[model samples]
Target: FAAVVGSVQDGGLPHAGCRCDNCQRAWADPAARAYVVSLALVDARGEQAAVYLIDATPDIKFQLEMVGEWLGPHPQRPQRINQPAAIFLTHAHMGHVAGLSQLSFESMAVQNLPVYGSVKLVGMLQETELWRPLVSQLDLLPIADEQTIVLAEGLSITPIGVPHRDEWGTGTYGFKIDGPAKSLFYMPDIDSLAQWAAAETVLNSVDVALVDAAFYDAGELRGRAAVRHASIHDTLAFWEKIDSQLVLTHFNHTNPLLNPAAPERAAVQAAGATLAETGMVFALD
Candidate 1:
C-alpha cells in the first residue's frame, strides 16, 4: 500500500505564524493538522513488509508511527525505529529533507541509513557544517536523473528531473514508482506544466499522479511574489490530458481548497481530480 501520510505544504497545517480560518481550525482541532507532504510505500505481500519513504518530512516522527505496524520491530530498542529501507529525497527543500535530523545521533541514532538523492544533494549534506554530524551517520547514495533504484523484486523507483527552484543546482525530482500492480508518478513541486518537456507523456504513463497543488489561484499569493509552484487552476486545465488518476496535494496554508465547503474543491472534482488527504492509501499489490 502507498500511504499519503501528510498532505500540506512545507510548514504544514497551523502554519508557523498564520491565523487564517483554516490555520485557526487546524490549531483548534488536532485532526485538522497535517504534516508536510510525504509518501510511504509498503510492500505488504509477505509476512514481513518493507517500507520506503519518498521524502524525509519534518513530521517524520509522527508519520513513522502511522506506518509503525508495517515497519515491524527494531533490532535493539523496544520501540520500532522510524527506519525505512531507504529514503528517496525529492529535493533539498526544508519540508522534504529536514527530518534527517531526527535520524541523527541526538535523536534516533540510526546507523547507515541509506539516503538517496542527487549527487549535489549528498555533497550539500556532507559539506554543510551544521549537518555534517548527521551526514556521517547516513549512507548517502547518489541518484541520477531517470535512474531507477530497485527496492525489491517487483518494486522500483525512478527519479525524473523536473523544473523547479534549484538553489544549489542539484535540481528537483518527481519519482515514478513502479509497483507490482501499477505505476505511480509523484511530482510534488514543479514550476509549471509547460516547463516539463515530457510532462504529458510521463503523467499518462502512470496509473496515479499526485501533483503539486500549492495554491488555487493568483489571489492566494496576495501581495507576496509568486512562488515557483503550479497552481491548482493550471493543473485542472490539463486534467483531460492526463490518463492517470489525478490527486492534488502540497497545499499552501493560503489555499482555499483547504476549506471543505470551498467551490474550488467541487470544481476540482468536477474536472475529474481528487485532493490528497492524510491516511489515504492506494494499493501497490
Candidate 2:
C-alpha cells in the first residue's frame, strides 16, 4: 500500500509569509494545515513490514509519525520511531530533499540509511562540504533513468526521468512503483505535460497516478515569475481520455481547489479525478 503523508506543494499550507484567504483559513485551523508532498510505500507480506519513503519533504517529522505503525520502534531506542528502510528522491528540489537534515546527527541520527537519487544529485550531496556530514551518515545510491530496483518479491520501483526546472543540471525523476497486483506512478513536480513526450504513455500505463496540481490556473500566479507547474484546468483536459485513476496532489497554497466549497473542487470531482489529501491510502493488491 502507498500512503499520502502530505499533499501540498513545497512551502506547504499557510506558505511562509503569505496571508492569503487560504493561508488565513489554514492559520486559524490546525486541521486545515497541510505538509509538503510525500508518499510512504509499505510491504507487509513478511513478518516485519518494510517501509520506504518517497521524497523526504520538510514536514518529514510529522509525516514519519503518520506511518509510525509500519515503521515500528527504533531498535536501540524504544521511545523513538525507526527510520525508513530507504528513501527514494525524485529531485534535488528543496521540498524533496530538505528533510535529510532531520535525519542527520542533530535529530534522528540515522545510520547508513539508503538514500537513492540521480547521479548528479547524489554527487552534489557527496561533494558539497555543507552536506558532507549528512552524506557520511547515509548510504548514497545513485540510480539511472528508467532503472528498475526490486525491493521485495513483487515490489519494484523504476525512476522515469522527466522534464522540470533544474537549476543545477540534476535531472528530475518520477517514480513508477509496481506492486504485486497493481501499479502506481508518482510525479509531485513537473514543468508541464506538453513538455514531456512520454507523459501520456507513462501515465496511462499505471493503475493509479498521483500527479502535480500546484495551481488552479494561471490566475493564481499573479505577481510571480513565469511558473512551470501545470494548472488543474490543463491537467484535467490532458487526462480526460485516460482510464487510470488520476489523483491530483502537490497543491500550491493559493490554489482554489484547496477549498472544498470552491466550484473548482466540485468540477474536479465531476471530472472523475480525485483530490489527494494527507493520510489517504491506496492498496496495491
Best candidate (score: TM-score): 2
lDDT of 1 by residue, 61-178 (tens): 8898899888888878866554778899999999999999999888888889899999898888888999989988899999999999998889899999999998889889999999
| lDDT agreement with native, every candidate | 0.89, 0.92
Per-residue alpha-carbon lDDT of model 2 for 1-285, expressed as tens digits? Answer: 999999998899989898998999999998889999999999988877889999999999999999899889999999999899999999998999999999999999999999999999999989989898888899999999999999999999999998888999889999999999999999999888889999889998999999999988777878645668877788888897677899999999999999878998998899888999998999998
Model 1 spans > 4 angstroms off: none
RMSD of each: 1.2, 1.0
For candidate 2, what is the TM-score? 0.98
Residue 182 C-alpha lDDT in model 1: 89
lDDT of the structure predicted as candidate 1:
0.89
**Total backbone clashes of candidate 1, pairs 3 or more residues apart or in separate chains:** 0
Clashing pairs in 1: none
Model 2, position 240, has a per-residue lDDT of 73
Model 2 regions more than 4 Å off: 223-225
